[model samples]
Target: MEKRLLDYLQKILNARVYDVAIESRLDPATKLSQRLGNQIWLKREDTQPVHSFKLRGAYNKMVRLSPDELARGVVCASAGNHAQGVALSARRLGCQAVIVMPVTTPTLKSDAVRSLGGQVILHGDSYSDAYAHALELEKKHGYIFVHPFDDPDVIAGQGTVGMEILRQHQHPLHAVFVAIGGGGLISGVAAYIKAVRPEIKVIGVQMTDSRAMLNSVTAGELISLPDVGLFSDGTAVKKVGQETYRLTRELVDDFVTVDTDAVCAAIKDAFEDTRSILEPAGAMGIAGLKQYIAQHNLRGESLVAITCGANMNFDRLRFVAERAEAGEEREALLAVTIPEERGSFRRLCETIGPRNVTEFNYRISHERTAHVLVGISINNRGEVPEIRRSLATQGFSALDLVDDELAKEHLRYMVGGRSQLNANEQLYRFEFPERPGALMRFLSGMHPDWNISLFHYRNQGADYGRILVGIQVPPADLATFRTFIDSLDYRYVDETQNPVYHLFLC
Candidate 1:
């Protein structure tokens, strides 16, 4: 082990990566430090030319190729950052580059490779399929295959990140957090860190659903997962590289498995400090770091997390934002039951006073009681039980839905439909400037004589709050109800006559 570590140390010292990669900044996260009571530093590998640390390994491996091999060019299979790295490296070396990506890969990623002068081939629906096709091409066309994580040269190139970190921060560091996928980055980082500063712990971070490395280490052998989750697609590897598995097991001090929600929260944390978004796998290190600090109850010690990549799909930001609060225990989802009486709904609202409601979905389900799916903004996890107790005191039964996957993804939106108690009900859509008390104020201002039959509201991170509401009003009072709505000055559209409403909600 000592000999192997020294060999990698020398290789990293001599690695040629400056041709395409940058020495990314190691910026301090001041806000996080203040909140967590730990001095946190981010190794900004996302600042690489391809917005990923993959370039360091790709360029390091390619620069040493023999003249004839360089002439033959190279090929690689990657669904994300690694593809961009090899493409950009081949461009700098004036070599032909062919990138094989799964057909399911987003066009944004494929187009990025093309923009870097790499030929793209969209193959089957998954990385395994694309990888098989790339191997076939390598044998058929005599192209050098640039393995993403397995090769010695590639690992050495990635180790340069560790070398740079040590040189940049000679101060006392308690631990270094690294995100692990097929394990190249962490293996390389662990190798260098352990060799040079053995006392400083090297920690590996992996998503709970795709923890091949962690499982392999635990089993004392390589293990292949039957499947992996796609939330952190970059790190969703079924099997880790053999070389990487060995190095990680020997050099890494510990491993932490984080869930998708925690990764989403970590992404939000990075954005807060740097005003930049991170891909799920890229933010895994930060998630692990926070977990470590909490579990160990450590404070005031310096720690580092590698911000590895930032090639995020724009559409995923909404899902991340929706789950981030839950990950940090800052939001609570509940199913509350209240008596189906005239004043019970109002009482429930009064009990929940002051706290912002992130979401609310309700329909008159039974003649005796009504069930509500509501989301409330919270300060921490401890607030959940307190809120439940408060609801109980008001004669409402509350079920915590914060960790319920079905409740969060599907049931929340499926809470309303046609009801037998909807007699004389009229539907309306209203848009008002969004603020903390918007929903509560609307409910309080409603006429006491009117009964609410259906209600749906979700915070979309938009400037305006849009809600769909159904109110039961007597036919004789239709004119007065219209006048009342007009007086509120909120933008409103009557959905009572909409064909879709009749089909789905009436």
Candidate 2:
């Protein structure tokens, strides 16, 4: 083990990466440090030339190739960060580069490689397909195949990140958190950190849905995942490389698995501290760091997390924003059932008093009762049980849906549609100030005889909130309802006779 580490250390020291990659800044996460009660540092690999640490390894391998190999060119298969890394490296080294990517690869990424002068080939439907095609081309055209994370040269190049981290901070670090996909980054980092600072724990983080390294280590052999989640697509590896898995298993001190929600929250956290949006996989290290500190109840310790990449799809930010609150335990989603009688809904609102309602969806599902899909902001996860207990005190039954993917992703939007039970329902859209008591005041001001048959609201992080509501009233009460709405002085639009409402909800 000593001799093997020595060999890697020598190679890392001699690795050539400065031609295309920079030694990125190690920035302090002040907000995270205060919140977690620990000093948190982020190694900003996302600031590299290709916006990822991949260039370090890609250039290290390509720069070492013989004249004949460089003349023949290099081919690689990548769908994300590594593709750009090789493209940038090959451009800097004055060599022809061919990057094979899945047909489903985003145009943003393929265009990025083309901008760097790499020939782009759109191949099969997945990375594995592109990889096989790249190998075929390599053999046929005498092109050197650049492995993303498997080769010794690549591993040594990535090790320089660890070297930079150690050189940047000489403080007492409790652990160094690294996100793992094929295990290459963590393997190289662990090799260096363990060799120099043996007492500092080298921890690996993986998305729960794509944890090939963790599963492989547990089984004492390589394991292939049948399918991996694509939310953190950068780290969604089916099988870790043989060399990477070996080094990771031997050198890594611990492992943590984080879910999509947690990763989203970490991205939000990173943004709060650094004002930079991190990709899901890039934020996994910070997510795992928080989990570890909380699980062990540790405080005042120093820790480091590598922000690995920033090649995020802009569209994914919407999904990440929606889940970030729940991921950080700042919001609780619940399915609350209440008696369908008049004033029961108001009482339920009173039960959730003083807390900001992040979301609410309801429809008159039955004659005697109603089910509400609600999201309430909370200080911590511990507040969920308290909220549930409060609902029970008011004769309401609440089902915790904070972790229910269906309720969060689909059921919330599908909560109310064409309810036969609400025959007399009149739909209206209302707008009011977005504040703790604003919603309560609206409920309190409604006439007691009027029955609320349906409702939909979502917090848009704006100064005011827009709500869609359905109220059931006798024909005689239409004039009074309009008068009451006018008295409230809130912005509202009458949608009772709208054709779309007639088609979808009436």
Candidate 3:
């Protein structure tokens, strides 16, 4: 089977299905290579026209269709790279292509499909749903279904990535890190690499929340997941392809699952090293490399990490930016409650000292209670211990929110919607202690009639923190609110007219 697949790949290569040329002299970065103590050569798959390795397989499969099949056209389901590949390939081959994509797929992706002359059908809400709908269209219209990663032809075509990796690197390669979803890319790469250079290790990486391939391999059979978390949406497969799983089980060296946090950290690292913004899936290979180094205690070994693709949602960058430091263990979040009395808030601020307060969120509800949430930055993961010790000595109650999903996702969004209509509503920016109960003191100090209208706080780990607070004030009560704010002895900025707050917060 392996021999037949190899011959088939060679035939596709000889047919000149791809227009892009592969680079052979790519070099390893001095900083990254030295840090990992390995000669690490990146495959640079992102350099392709579609900025992914998908084109190789899509073209290889499409170009080999018989005249009858080509006449009937072809159909596929993809949200990003695969969709682009099939669209371009279909246009070049003079065949009609119909692509089914999830409704949640971005407009940019759908537009790209149309731009390449492919008829795109938006259906369902996920890749799996789109795929099922595509199957129905394939049967009804008699269009040839182009399998994204499961077919033999597709696997053979993707094997070209492994072939290029071997030809491009100079030093002896000890290991290769590949990201896994349905296992098409890794299966192809592993089959070829193990067949030719069996000594070289082929490790696979998957996001912990979407480890279909990893779980299947461990279970000794294909096991489908009911649902998968989609932080790395491109690689969020619930089931591994049957053939891909068979090849992976036999040829792949090992598998590792990295959490969302690790993937975020790897994205930052890849950007810093290559000035490239890798999507979470693209960064999986590098995250696996870090994990492999730590797990096996292997240092100074030659390795290669495939930087797969860069088709990332622009809005998702904000989430990545917010979590990168904490994912890397360079920042920590805490919820602290302090006494709701005069000078208590000031004393809490004194305890924070020069340490930067990245975020400060406060809400006052009850007559005598306030809840304050704060995030702080540290030099490294190791510094967390010292920071905790200091907070303990300062008599502040702290609850870490670094790994709290609820706090990160929902609680932060719902923090400041509480407001009672009052004649003395005012919006003030206050720098408060990050400790707990600090918010209660702020609320306690306010008059009973005052109501909070808007609140927004994001932790950036900075010293002398700032928080936006909205309080309801009647037209005649402005002086009273101003006097109350002035007595608190904190700087205040009025942003009731800020366009951003009005549009997003109000």
For residues 106-218, write the lDDT of model 3, one tens digit per residue: 56667877998999998865578778999999999999999888987888777878877876764578899999987878988887777667889999999887888888889
1-506: candidate 1 lDDT, tens digit per residue: 47889999999999999989889999999999999999999999988888889998989999999889999989998877889999999988999999998765655678899999999998864566778899999999999999889899999999999999999999999999999988899888888999899999999999998899999999999998876666776786888899999999988999888998899899999999999999888899999999999889999899999999988878678878988988898999988889989999899899999999988888775789888878999989899999999999999998887876546644567666767678999988877645556677778877888999887776543334558788999999899999888877666778788544553365
* Rank by TM-score (best first): 2, 1, 3
**Local distance difference test, each candidate:** 0.86, 0.85, 0.74
Q: Who is ahead in lDDT, 1 or 3?
A: 1
Give the lowest summed-lDDT range of ten residues in model 3. Answer: 497-506
TM-score of 2: 0.82
Off by over 4 Å in 3: 1-17, 20-27, 34-37, 341-353, 363-371, 412-506
Clashes of 3: 23
Least well predicted 10-residue stretch by lDDT in candidate 1: 457-466
C-alpha RMSD in Å of predicted model 2 compared with the true structure: 13.0
**Of models 1 and 2, which has the larger lDDT?**
1
Q: Each candidate's root-mean-square deviation in Å?
A: 12.5, 13.0, 12.0
